[model samples]
Target chain A: MIMEKLKLNIKIFFEGAYLSYVGLFRWLSPSTYLATLIFSPLTQMLFFVLIGTYAQGTDKAYFYVIGNALMNAAMSGIYGVTMSIGGDRWDGTLPYLFGAPANRMTVFLGRAFMHILNGMIGVLTGLLWGWLLFHIDYSAANPWALLLTILVTTFSTSGLGLLMGCIGLITRNVMFVNNTVYFVLLVFSGANLDLATLPSWMRIVSNYLPLTRGIASARLIIAGHSLTEVLPLLIEEFGIGLFFALLGYSLFRWFEITAKKRGTLEVF
Target chain B: MSAIEVINLQREFQTTIGVFNRKKKIVPAVKGISFEIAGGELFGLLGPNGAGKTTSVKMLTTLLIPTGGTAKILGLDIVNDAEAVRPRIGFIFGGERGLYWRLNATDNLRYFASLYYLDPAVSKKRIPYLLEMVGLTDRADEKVEGYSRGMRQRLHIARALLHDPEVLFLDEPTMGLDPVGARELRQTVRNLQDEKKTILLTTHYMFEADALCQRVAVINKGEIVAMDTPSKLKDSVNDLSVVEIEVFGIPPETVEKIKTLSMVENVSVEDRDQLQLLLVHTSKGAEAIPLLISELNGLKLGKVTTREPTLEDAYVRLVGGE
Candidate 1:
């Protein structure tokens, strides 16, 4: 019986994940998809890379490349996952969702599952852009360690997305909040500036965030460092990601109860 | 056991007025209204716009937490056993909005079926059956955005029945459909009744309630004014007759003047394009018609006739023709 329940939960998780992701892009033409998931991120990366290389010199292009590449995870995790969750309210499907008998945890977390994968793809795509445009060297990198770093980073960022998605449930200004947080991560995740040159307080702030360790770990892995050398950072990054995901899940549950109580499940 | 039961159920919304020093006002939407439905009975809650019909339905469906009282669906308390209650009941708010517009009808059903935790094996068989049941089998693969309002409404029905819920709450299911579409939808509803599904349908159309419901509760201002079988409710106006006087451009003061007539019990107007239909309920019957025409002195008049009171006259009389 327990096995059957678990199997059913797993099925709900994946099916919800896939369907919601498909729902998010239902209006997208091939051009829109390319513009959103590909060209938009690519152009943003190029702008930041150009500014970084111009200020620090050409040799430091790898630093900017790795930093901006990982930002793609935040891009997908924050914007994509939030949209998947918030879409229920905008599309008037929230009531049916709330009315369903499905496990709340499964349905809530399933929202982030597809975005995690999408974020991973987005990060990988950014890295590909890095290689094609700037000739960044991946020859010395441990492929497995880098892959692990990307997964952790995307997972952590998606956790933040889940939290923002819950906030979207109550507030009409969700897109404004999403844009602000994305830019905040860009500044504070050490995506652009060198951590050492920054003030001590900013460095302290970076340590508590998701991508700080993941980005540092990715840089180390690419410079031919063994996985063991950066094992502590990877562990911390994974923990941070887990923390946000759980926190988001909690907020999601709270929002559901509160909306039902306040009779605002589909108010917006 | 009753398929659905309610006791003094209520819901109040708190809204703030004004920007500076905003004052919170508690507005009661469903004011402690109560009713029950027997298993396998087709029940209707008849009310006008803003009559708390939707709010009452929302609370019973576990979509809104009541401010007072309690409700049970299939013996499960709506508030406490909401999780268990959800699987046993389905609801359609009756519009194009509840569906995933981007998805094909088939995908929409599959997704909702997962939300209801239906086994894949069951949903696979059930989706096609429901699509056929609602007469959307041919358009099952088309995106809902491409569907007409009626088709979308049909898909809404299909989605709600994906789990084969024992009780269905349909709020204004045919609100915006054309006559033929509404008839088709009503037919589908009747078929569901034939299948022994307990249905609680809320609508403002009295004829609809008369034609479809075994029992209906006439609600106004968040309270049920009367609850009984449609025929019994209509029988409340049996001594009365409805004189529908078709007039062109009747003034508001003239309507108020006619309401003052000793023979008029209640007066309500229906706007039919260029003409206004004056539906006057009175025990005087045809005798009241000449008095009404005399009051309408200068207005251009059309077909003026008296007919037997219907469920609508009963409704207009009970609610005082708002």
Candidate 2:
């Protein structure tokens, strides 16, 4: 009986993810995905690579490319999760979702699963872009470590994204909050800038951010480090991700109860 | 056990009232209302716009938390046992906004079926049946955005019935449909009634309540002003007659002048395309028709007729002409 229940819950989770993807893309044209998902990230990569090559010379181009590549995963996770909830609110379907008989955590985390997967896809595609454009060498790197880094990074960052989506329950204008979070992740996740370049306080702040540890580990793996060499960082990344996922889910439930009491859940 | 029960339910919302110098105002949306609905009973809540009909339904469905007092659905408290209550209830808020316009009608129903945790085998059978029942089988695969308003409303009904919930709450389910569409939807609702589901329907249309509900509660300003069988409610205004005047380009002042008459019990206006249907209730009946004509001497009246009172007359008399 327990096994059957778990299986059912898992099925519901995947179905929720699939439905969310359909909701996100049903009205969107193909060209819009080509522009937003593909060309846009590649252009940002090219621009950053060019600047890094010019400022610090050709040697640092690989660092900048890999850094920006990993950040795409974070972007997709944040935008995907935040927009999932925000879009429901805008379309006036949030009330139905709230009134559903399903468990609240299952509904929310299930909706979030696709965002995490999309984030990993973004990271992998960005890496392909890096390898094709910058000729970044990964022949000596451990493929397993690289894949693990991408998965962990996407998971952790998606938790933070889910948290931002929870904040969207109170402030219906999620775009503003998402944009602010996106900027913070870009600047403070140790992606574009080196840890030495940031002030001591800022570097400390970067430690607690979603992608910092994951990105650092990814960089080391790209530089030919073994999975064992980066075990501590990977562990820390997993812990952070789990912490955020739990925290975000708790906050989501808290916000839901409060919104019901305040009668603001469907006001938008 | 009663299918639904409420004791002194209250809900107040804080809103900023002014533009520049905003003052936080506490609006009592549902104020100290109490009621009971028996199992398998078709009950109606009749009220005007913002009369807290939707708020009360939302509260009962566990969508909103009440500020004070308590509500129980099928022996489960709405607040403390919401999860236990949810699986047994379904609701459909009127109009097309609630549907996913990108997905087709079948997908919409399938998605909600999963949300209600219906098994795949059940949804596979139930989805097609619901789509056929709502007369959307032909267009079930078409995206909801391409659907007409009536079709979308029917699809909303299909989505609501996906889980075969024991209790159903419908808020203004026929608000914007054409006459045919409204009648078809009402037939579907009547079929559901035959299944003995406990239905709590909130509608402003007295005829709808009179036709479908076994009993109704007339609410005004968040309070139950009247509650009884449709026949009993209509009998309250049995001595009154409704004089309906279909007039084109009737000025507002003329309608007011008619209302100010000593014999005029109440006046309600229904706006048609270019003409206005004025329904005036009075004990004088045909005796007041000539008085109405003389009062509107300048305007060209199209057709004037007097008929007996309906549930609508009882409603107007109870709510004092909203």
Best-performing candidate as measured by DockQ: 1
lDDT of 1 by residue, B183-293 (tens): 999999999999999999999998999999999998999999999999998888899998999999999999999889888899888999999999898899898877888
lDDT string for model 2 (B1-322, tens) is 7899999999999989879999999999999789899988999999999899999999998989999989999989999999888888989888778887787888888778878888888899999999999899999999888998889888887777788888999989999989998999899899988889899999999999999999999999999999999999999998899999988888888889888999998887899898889899999999999999898788778889999898988999999999
For each candidate, the DockQ is: 0.82, 0.71
| Model 1 stretches astray by more than 4 angstroms | A26-28
Ten-residue segment with the worst summed lDDT in candidate 2 chain B?
Answer: B95-104
Clashing pairs in 2: none
What tens digits encode model 2's per-residue C-alpha lDDT throughout A161-214? Answer: 778777776686777878888889888988889988999999998888888888
Which pairs of residues have clashing backbones in candidate 1?
Answer: none
Candidate with top lDDT is 1
Which of the numbered candidates is closest to the native, going by highest TM-score? Answer: 1
In order, the TM-score of chain B in each prediction is 0.98, 0.93
Candidate 2 docks with a DockQ of: 0.71
